[model samples]
Target chain A: MTVPVPFLLGAAALTLSTAMQSPARAQSAPAPQIALSCAGCHGVGGAGEGSVPRIAGYDRQAFVDNWSAFRANARPATIMNRIARGYTDAEVAQLATYFASLR
Target chain B: MTRLTRRAFGLSAASAGLAFAAPATLSAQTQARLVIIGGGFGGASAARYARIAFPNVAVTLIEPKTSFVTCPYGNLLLAGERTLPQITHSYDGLKARGVNVVHDWADGIDATAKTVRLRGRATVAYDKLILSPGIAIRWNAIEGYTEAAAEALPHAWIPGAGEQTTLLRRQLEALPDGGVVGFAIPPNPFRCPPGPYERISLVASYLKRHKPRAKILALDAKDAFSKQGLFQDAWNELYPGLIEWVPLNKDGKVTRVDAQAKIFETELGTRHRVDVGNVIPPQSAAKIAIDAGLTNETGWVPVNPRTFEATRARDIHVIGDANVGQVMPKSGYIANSTSKVAVAAAVAALEGRPAPEPTVYFNTCYSHVGPEYGISVVGVFRPSENGFVETPNSGGVSPRGPLAEQREQRRLEALHADAWYGAITRDAFS
Candidate 1:
């Protein structure tokens, strides 16, 4: 089984964002439970660590576009492609807004 | 961004503060009473999220235990990597967050009265009730296996720190070198599909160090299991010639056991005498769910995929292992995720607001094959007309491959698993 390169890149981006943000700003509202699930891989607040990317400050439009691409199979993905299909376009937008609201 | 209306503004204000003070506009409405039973991952999370999501609503968690010992990492205890204290969690953090933590058994649910009767306590009324009462062992599913038999053979399937788990560990320790250890794995749809295999791996890990000559025989009811390839690969690589798995086709299904003689008989009529026997009997929804008539003929509660409300009872939602027909596996992650969705719907109903739609659920199950070799499976699901379906291309098992990459990835996942344990436990209890 090969780990998807795009997934790793996405996680790396989250890690970069985590390093740039202040610890205080990282401590925000309690994430809705769905988003909180990401903490296992994306770090607390989606800060990202090591290979994971910083998703907390992602542009809402970018977030939506990425997930939409994954859902549509229009992007190179590993697990995200399958995960993205779990939500409707509206939920993707809501999640994007949720993550973007952090910073 | 949509402009915040008065109601949305009040909700935002209420969420911003830790105190359970409802906004003036929201306080005028009837006080909402949300009672959640069985303070496991699902119920505890529902209680905490309801407190934060709707401060005006009163959240009460009815659990018999003051502290919970999670099943997530209980295998580590068998390997002597972790102690009981490390996995125990207190409900004080939940109480501090304005949740009423009631220590009592929820004996029965009076759905008509919208109340839950407690053992030796007053009945608690609820506008919305969430039941996460995990699984109940089907005592007689395997002939000769009963509650009394567990004390001798010890299933250790349930999440009790000093009880079943400790008993199993003590049994393993007392076994002499070269003693045979046997496990009778249940059929499909059991809690934590990958769990028994993980336990087998950990037991092998322990025996490898303490009793290098000891052997493990796993008689499984199913032909395949979660992450089978991954687990088999790790067993071969790490503890070669130590573990043997017998599938159902080979008469792996255990029919009966003589606890006194320490012998297990399988469907093939082959009896195996072992020094230690770990029999994970068949399972169903907890007794409370069956008693309340929330469960179906399948012995699992059927629920609306969208709201997780019981099909038979209005205002009562079931999440966690008790709920069935969901695409998601019966694991802790799914329990936590479904709990949030249930809480969100319940709060919306209490406030007379439209429920949120297009909900997404996620689950990632990490199994430690050894101290450093971990594997995982991920799934993302959405409600469909029939039931919940996995989002295509979203979830899959951990990658298998070149030894170097596999080893590194497994090590990283082991670390991630620990982090996940902390994050999820905190999410539920703290």
Candidate 2:
């Protein structure tokens, strides 16, 4: 049986995420680790269920713009604004790219 | 070779094929096995995350029940807002995702041998184990409150099969129009700190429509609770004169329960007679965890902050209310959120890498106080010295205001609570 590409990587998820990091965040926490937290509310893999909006397969630029808006309080949100403030700019960028990569 | 030696060799060989750029040579039989115990918020989420993120690792979930009833929205069933079918979830979703879902009780664990002995006389091996067996009501923690007594005075705490919740609902239905309902709330550090109070609120919401003259006597063992101010505010406004909450300072701690007489006796020896009785006894980690020697004297497991690996065991990670995550409240939201971290850490250890660092865990516990009225508390935690610490200024409760001023806010939050339930269950089961 042929295993999927990700499954072949196994624990390499951590190292692979680290490999894709920018210089400023070269030693930062992996993107997949941060993205997992969103699964609590956004559904596994950010596939939206019910009223929770879908984050998976989102446009990379749109994800970044939405994060910036929520962080700046320029948009109305019940919980996202508060949750956004807890994450750094670099982490948010990484999450944006990570979710965008999902199917 | 010895069983232990052969198992260690199998695990190391599994890790050898997991390098970043290694060829895909591992077959189904050669994959690492991840065995998860219990199928609640923690185990289900961990199983699902493992399938999505670590597809190379085979997952086996051992749970006694084929479907799960959530404890989060159980209070809504008492209020008649939701039905039992609404909260029950099937393991079919996990099976569809390629997880080996076994409906068997996990009788014991052998951490050294890396195997779990099931009640069905079969032993399954695991390269890494995730134990999320949830909590067990310490029966008789209150005098005269044994497991048998629970048939009459149901705790309705565990999410097992939805029987306790449904039994409590039937009792409420049988109560007279002007009868009294008494709740013996437990002390702090129990599963869902805000749960008992929410039960009281929803039961009151039900009584107000069906039995207006009904009274609620909530005798809490502790003085403070999650969102105490907000819960009290809702009680006074929506359920005025219907809820009577007694704090610990006022002799509110229940020392004994006369289940047959339908009575609750306090520490000060005051007896309270009621038409219906709900007793939430003290709790600890589930029996399997205790039997495996994973729990400490406090009856809870202590784990590394980042890895969630039990301090007493190797190749075993503990999550959910079973672990001593002191800074975080033992809520389903925390269990679901921490599960992914635990899975990642377990896989990292299999490959001999460090546990994910600087991990930020998020929790949002939303509770409904009345019809179209809801409230919640948000907390963000990160690993600190040997435990977790709340992220400063990151999370807070819903803004407190009078009903008339914040009517729309309450209505929207109630809707949001429903949406959250749907999304979270899908995340875990579907």
- Model 1 misplaced regions, further than 4 Å: A1-36, A40-54, A58-93, B1-29
lDDT of 2 by residue, B127-157 (tens): 8899999999898889999989999999999
lDDT of 1 by residue, A1-103 (tens): 2111132322332244334445654545445546756754565567764555678888999999888888787996534665676666766776787889886
Provide TM-scores for the models: 0.85, 0.90
Q: Which candidate is the best by TM-score?
A: 2
> lDDT per prediction?
0.80, 0.84
| Model 1, TM vs. native | 0.85
lDDT of 1 by residue, B87-108 (tens): 8999999999889999999999
How much RMSD separates candidate 2 from the native structure?
5.4
TM-score of 2: 0.90
DockQ of 1: 0.13
What DockQ do you compute for every candidate structure?
0.13, 0.25
- Docking category for candidate 1? incorrect
